[model samples]
Target: MSDEDLRLSADRVLARLVGDPTDSARLREDQWRAIEALVAERRRALVVQRTGWGKSAVYFVATALLRERGSGPTVIVSPLLALMRNQVDAAARAGIRARTINSANTEEWDTIQAEVAAGEVDVLLVSPERLNNPDFRDQVLPQLAAATGLLVVDEAHCISDWGHDFRPDYRRLRTMLADLPQGVPVLATTATANARVTADVAEQLGTGEGTGRALVLRGPLDRESLRLGVLPLPDAAHRLAWLADHLDELPGSGIIYTLTVAAAEEVTAFLRQRGHTVASYTGKTENADRQQAEEDLLANRVKALVATSALGMGFDKPDLGFVVHLGSPSSPIAYYQQVGRAGRGVEHAEVLLLPGREDEAIWRYFASLAFPPEEQVRRTLDVLAASDRPVSLPALEPQVELRRSRLEIMLKVLDVDGAVRRVRGGWTATGQPWAYDAERYAWVARQRETEQQAMREYATTADCRMEFLRRQLDDEKAAPCGRCDNCAGVRFTTEVSAASLDAARGELGRPGVEVEPRRMWPTGLPAVGVDLKGRIPADEQAAPGRALGRLSDIGWGNRLRPLLAPQSPDAPVPDDVAGAVVTVLADWAKGPGGWASGAPDAPDRPVGVVTIASRTRPQLIGSLGERIATVGRLPLLGSVAYHDGEIDTRVPRTNSAQRLRALHGALTVPPPLAAALAEAGGPVLLVDDLADTGWTLAVASRLLRRSGAAGVFPLVLAVQG
Candidate 1:
């Protein structure tokens, strides 16, 4: 087709996409350039444009033109389920038959693949993780790569380690690209990519050695419709109160972003209590609930959805009038991607950031989960190499010190590098020479630190907030956005009503979270030198326990974080913390399923208090146990002693099997405690400062039960999420 004909065809498709069938809608020059590059020249291209800048239109229009020319289906590697759903619906409007095969719709995979093979589907979208699936990678991906006319990589920055949301699975795209039939066009698009990330992605998108460089079309990153601002509050309570007071006054229905899942739920509950319609959306949200919440926000049926980064990409509500962040993201690039969700279709939308003091702590915790050390990586490779058959993740987990999630990630990277291969049962060693890239990992870590420092500057800087973010992305056109808080002299007020403030305080201050007991033992314990397996006998299980609050909770978490820091000196429980602990006990005693409940099934009241001897916080846990026993008028049974203080501090945050192995036989019941339990004649209270893995509580409870206590009730100061 001639250039003019291709442009005309693309313009007609754009009209259909926007519901203007009269051909009044037309593609922008850059959009036409990309479509022409793919169709006319069969060239790979990378388009780095801001959000809502018609990146989707370029691919859909290109798909229409290519299919009309008898090309095979356009295969899109989408990141999120939400994004896939939106693109599928959008494709239908342009008369393109689009189907997705993702985790959400596994039952439809065979049908979708069949349709694509039949050339009945115009576009087929699959997640990045799907490319690494053993069956899909070995069976379906090769055939798809052969027949595919155009491959679209949405959110392409994810392929680069420097990208803020990088995933190891995305690197699998390299193999697919290398195997693609010659002259098959590819397009990679992203809304957030600095210069380094852009260069990295473009280089990777190039189909190996002989395929010349990809055409790069970079554009400005300015969103004219957004008005950015930052409103600093005294604390979490004040921040919540300010949101409760000002949410409704925002232009229209929008999102309230939180840095953590606990914060999302907390904000949602507080907003609902304040008579505002809201829902919580996080990675933990059920798929059906997330779908419903997305629909509700789109239809303006609810005021807002308090969400984490799970709702960041591919949600296309162009008229969303506001974007509010309860806590700042760790990277300015990530903050830009999230806030870009707002003001896409509207001319005026409010973007506010209420920075919290806890953001850096949360950042540090996440940073610790980065790629493991070279020693751990080598150990994992050695284990796989020694195995005769493919090792399932659960079976491999007991041998590797890495957590299951981290282990899976490491395996995916190895698979992409040819060091390992994911097979029918699980993963197998390829005996491929793989060098640990310590220097590269260290460079990425340093880059992350730089991003963190930039985010700090973003929150505290008095300059234009949008401009600061744009510059972080290496945008050359990042002139001062004249409509920001610093530029426009602060469009919002920090004053919150006294009533709202008090209500927020009450909601945050009221504490007492249920600690669900560990039911079944970790699998493959025998492999870890522990003699446990299958269901934990119900008789040996600890009863459901209570904690004053969660370390991730916005309310009590803010207070407990500093008190429990690794550097915190061991001391007696402070007066305020002790008082809160008392309040939790008061509530738990009268609540349902409590021993003091007058119900028929309630257990007998705890007869004594048994504390777990803590190597780090003995003063805190000991004093807490003494105070509880004195308050309840129960005898203080001797503490559960660790034999030779053989505690493995490294096991606290590790996988279940490793933790259980470390704790087996390490804790013992003292003879005095056994005698006291024999005399008490009723249930006893187990006091500990914290319950991170719940392993200690479970082991201690079993010992108490075997030693003659009728029941064990665990009382802890905090629970870690």
Candidate 2:
């Protein structure tokens, strides 16, 4: 029969099977037009679209239409056994005849093959690995070559090296299609692909340029309901603590992603200890265990799940409310896919990235480990090339002396290069040259390097974290999302009180203080104040007038010095100067009742205290002193009042503005240079080198107030106001 006449007869058979003489299934207009053109011209076609864009719907409806026209039986090639089962189940739901062939059906395989050869099976779904069976080619292909109506390749991106999930067996599909009878329509579908992947899909399906055809349906990449955020923390422990605090606030199904199988187990154990029913899935898990874990999550037996990235592909549960990465992935594409798993049904979802300094290092190590040496590549090629047909890894391993771990890594690399195809229990050489050019391997290596660099940059960048990620993905045009850590305006704050400063300065400037090599102390060290001279000596020095002037040249003349001592003068003061120096005063000494006492020697042990100027406002000072006195045995250092004239306010405020003036007063307090300052019972002293209107001091005092601080007192070396 002529090609046209055979095509006409096939159309009649397809119409009868699908029950739709004219397909009216809703599909993107462009895709519909492309399919119609394919059918009209009697040529093969491939369609690629983003995930959730209805690629399956297009092919399924088209299959129905073609079948209604009496087209011969159609065949579908899929990668996963579960996906094949899903397809068969879906067809059954639609009241169409469909069957699947895989390793699970040992006894039924021959019967199914015979049924397909006899045109008794309307649709047959099989894995690419199954097609490598010689019987399929010798028997099924000839029959299908004569009457095959349609061939569909789902998740066609798997055939391309550029795709996230590359499969070796997919490479042989083009050769298999070439062997099929001319004008037997081919339809390929996939959810995600970039330009390179798109080209690869077309080429692998034997639908290139003019001989065959391709149609791409683009969809919006943005997911409005998916809120993205990144959190920077000192360590994983802190991250766990943060998650613990926020877990209750984040209700609904959630997935916490970790980088390693061990981390997944660790985090899951930690969460379980905290009373959360958590399940973990990682590569180390047995298939039965993984399946059970997935089922438990789906059945709501667990509210939270901790897993490695292996849990996501082909597992569809629509209500996932959150996806959090315990560490950053190597590329934005990897992250995008993992996060995309959440909110698949278009519900509001949140994705958080909790990263630390070690995350990048771990990923780089893994990448280096995953990159196989050229020798391993050569061996993989040699073995596959020697095999007349595909050889299973189990059989090939006997010939290669490399460890299985190393061998598998090499196989994955070769699979990505399209040098060999993975068949059921074996590996097949496609007989076609590797799709990648020599430079392509270098490009992939560089791409991996770039991805690692991008991940490191994402973790370390000071800019808006989300903006950095969006830009890395070539989505720079996207606006800054306001929900991330950068947008939320959270920062670390350390408040140094006058008491802590004096204590640190006393220890650092003590005569023969016997400073430890590391300055390590059994108890924590106290905060210390530094003079304008920025030097520390055992003894008091002349007024640092000139040094203070020099400090004023910089805006930091009023800034607090954390851990520096002021320079001493040529002259020395006696060590016996008792009350002149405010030592570490006890918290009780500053409270109401303890205000009656004067500065005493350092307590044998640690005690929280603040020494205020005696000349300062008594009510304010006394109230603080009384609060300090509540520490009982810890003596309250009587409020040492300072001459109002010695104090300066950079920003002046009226007495009626108690809030502002008080805030200003606290910010200008002089600090004893120290890394950290502790507060007494109630009032905390905030010291700055210079002070303006004390807005910063006031704001900080407000923060302390929220922390149950009685009040804030300010001390400054210089005052502009």
Q: How does candidate 1 fare on TM-score?
A: 0.99
Tens digits of per-residue lDDT for model 2, 1-721: 4445534444443344335557333345655554564455546666644344545545555566567667877788877554665567556644567888866677998788778767677788887765545677456656665677878888787777666666655665765676667666777776555557767777666643345554444443555556776677554456666665566556477788887665676567666766678888887777667768777776768877788877644555667778888877777656766776677665567778887544554555465444455665666687788768777654554345343455655565565456665656567766666533557667766777787787777666666665665454444254666655566554322223344344333322322100011111111011112111222221211111101111111112112121111232221212221111122233233433333344463212223333333222333334434443353344443332223435333232312122233333343223331112324434444323333333333344344444434444443333331
lDDT by residue (tens digit), candidate 1, 1-721: 6778778888999999989957899889999999999998999999999999999999999999999898999999999988998999999999999999899999999999899888899999999989989899989999999999899999999999999999988999999899998889999999999999999999998866556899999999999999999898999999999998999899999999999998999999999999999999999999999999999999999999899999999899999999999998999999999999999999999999999988888888889888899998898889889989999998888777777888898898888889999998999999979999999999999999999999889888989888899999999999998999988888899999999999999999998999889888877778768888888787788899999988878889989989999999999999899888888888888889887778899889999999999878989999999899888888999899889766556664556666667778989998988999999888898999889878889999999999998888899999987
TM-scores of the models, in the given order?
A: 0.99, 0.56
Please give the CA lDDT of all the candidate structures.
Answer: 0.91, 0.53
Worst 10 residues of 2 by lDDT: 512-521
**To one decimal, what is the Cα RMSD in angstroms of model 1 from the true structure?**
1.1
